[model samples]
Target: LSLHPVSVLVLKVNEVSLGIEVRGEDLAVALQAEELSLQQLGTVGLWQFLHGQCSDISFQESSALKTDHIRPAVGLRFEAGPGAAVHSPLATQNGFLHFLLRGCDLELFTSVLNGLGPFLEDEEIPVVVPMKIELLHSRITLKDDIPPIYPTSPGPVPITLAMEHVVLKRSDDGVFHIGAPAQDRPSAEVPKSEKRQSAKEQMFLVPTEEAFGQLVKELPTLQKELRETKQALADANQEKDRLLQEIRKYNPLFE
Candidate 1:
């Protein structure tokens, strides 16, 4: 009965340079992406691209990426200011956190959600979606039941966490938001994936009218190419059949 949409992204020292970890969780937890860079896209977006493969200039820069960088940790519960709309002139920057939750204490994680009840409450439904946390200078303690993949002491250790969510457009203004608002969703238009990418990120655009016309004009050429290919295949098959017939004729068994 507690099914919620949750997306997590992991950015580790070396194990995971960049990748998306798609998972379904009963508890809805949204972690804000920091720096809002294209690197975050590799893990959040339905369509994924490698760090350097994307058009992000930072990815292209040799010194931009570093695995040893110790990411900031955030609290289990926190507050977020109203984010600027994508189309808003006042929209400048929002420092977000990226978190990864794996092999951790589920009960403890659930307990942490206790503080987020107010923020997660949805007016349209009975379910609650937790407010996105910004883990800054805090460590997440794991349960003893889960085996430790990374080196850890007898107690808790710090880990990276990344967040993904549907981009919501404010009805009042066209600006996009990271977390869902209490307002009705239908009025918000169809939500889009809110994976932050760099300005240099590339996307496949729909063809223009002129481009479509050109493609229509080239249909005859394409059909001609197809016809020529079929003909060549037919000619090759005929040659093969003739060669086989000649071989059978020359056989002593025929004589």
Candidate 2:
């Protein structure tokens, strides 16, 4: 299948880090077309805002990797059997990370992005077809019903290559997994044995190329919606804090 280009969102939720991405030419084109439809229909102002300016569109992808620093092991112990007891030092890094994609073939995915030079030109919004990447983690232990290592701040950081494949494998809750070819794996005519064997060889993938293309087109809209929702939650929390402070001043019972 032909992988489309689109923005990807990577989330590191506890020990289950995951990268859920989208890839599909037809899908991407279809999303853009649908958004265009919404624009034409004037159902929502937002659709009109994104319509035709190439603002609501996306591209197909090759392969891209976002990384985190090498997490040092916390503690170690010796055991008599093949396995050894150990306690890992918690992994730490800046809390927020963001990445952008340009529409290009798989061949140029890495080199072009890596060599992306100084802010010379305008932030080049690309003409990708449609694609996505959702990366997640679930290593953190449960403490008080939440990830033991939740962050309160945000910043940009790189994902380490050594654990990159591991991140992909751990994406779906560290389930039984497989590796498959990107392009060839997406096709329906391809035999199942071939798909399974290729999966044995591939690092990770969801959906065939055709399916991926259709799926990919919606990533940006979904991501935008997610971000806005998160921001709203943060705002609500801030408001709650303000009200609590006011209560502490006026309410004599607690005092």
Candidate 3:
């Protein structure tokens, strides 16, 4: 997908004695589009933020790599504020975003994102495209419940890519949730020989090029609202301080 010229949030990586830790900050990842409705953009934001961070990481063995594993094993921690969901035009509820990823291909994904930098910046990236990386033995947990890892074919069990085919929904309670993709039967589109392939074997996606554009278009409006709210809060605090000072004038302790 196309990434516009927006502020990028970077993820930080740390290699401890046990394993690798990847952490990213909140980033705007919402698309104000009519074709596909997105109630929450946390998943998308997390990917973009992490991708940006991965670019900043130093790949030297003496610096970042410490473990004996051939490929770096990664654990992802994602967090975003309620207001970060810029997709919904009228989102009043301040929801929270949290998720974790295990056994993802950090190196390959990082390389892919880095390669797409020029294209994304120029808004020339293709829409609905698939990448070469797959997350093997990876599991993602959103909020409280962890989705069950479904078995695929000969490659690996519970494989997932970035946010390609993954589906998330907002429940009746207005909470965004992630669940396992339904697999009742094989599709007609798939060949009979490949029907037994697992969910991870299939491609999944995050936000599309159109969706990214929509988000960029909506960011300015949100920023204006945020500025006005902050000004109002500052004014209120000043008024409170004035009243406190006036009260202190009548107290002997002030002398």
Candidate 4:
């Protein structure tokens, strides 16, 4: 039996983004439900992302969010350097598994175990499970399969909280109202339906997040990239200026 635990953020109703950490319990159920819905996604890559099936969901990157704006607040964020955690996707259900890994591929972990069934003839698929679930097959099947309506972002990495298991936390701005029944609201990346908002602005961001520490780590990377780009632009401009001066030297302004 092949199964892998994928850390994914609920980015939209159908579509979602993944990162390093995830609401493992929430995501376990959500993604199982998501994969079951799009058994077909195994074949087409990126197609589902654009259809409003998903969205990009990420963390606030700053400080404590107002308690009111927070959804599924787990209490804290994970630290860096879990890169080795991500492994080859589980081979169960064929290529269908990788689709669910899209956004949270880094946090995903795969395992092999004997598959048990009612008939006692189940195949060992090297099953995957979030660090929480011990009996992978006991979990519901079809509930995980839901057709995505878009695409999503990678999720945050797992953090071992004071309680051992990583706890969910929020960095929301505390202004927007995130609706109820958690599952009812779509993931952040679901594309806007054409019947809605001229179909351009509705489906927006893919769900993903991180805490202050993450941005702190990324800040240096962002700055370095920006500096390199700025220098490249300056060199290009200097070359253009030299060429223009040469052209002016040979051309008549009034003629």
Measured by TM-score, the strongest candidate is 3
TM-score of each: 0.24, 0.21, 0.26, 0.22
- Candidate achieving higher TM-score, 1 or 2: 1
C-alpha lDDT (0 to 100) for residue 142 of candidate 2: 13
CA-lDDT, candidates in order: 0.33, 0.29, 0.36, 0.29
- Kindly list the per-residue Cα lDDT of model 1 for residues 84-177, writing each as its tens digit: 2332222222222223222121112322333357567777753222222221222233223333577654645534333222223322233324
**What's the count of clashing pairs in each model shown?**
12, 57, 7, 76
Ten contiguous residues with the weakest lDDT in model 1:
197-206
Cα error of candidate 4 at position 74, Å? 23
Arrange candidates, best TM-score first: 3, 1, 4, 2
Top candidate when judged by lDDT against the true structure: 3
Angstrom error at residue 146, model 4? 27
Off by over 4 Å in 1: 1-211, 252-255
RMSD of each: 23.3, 25.5, 22.3, 22.3
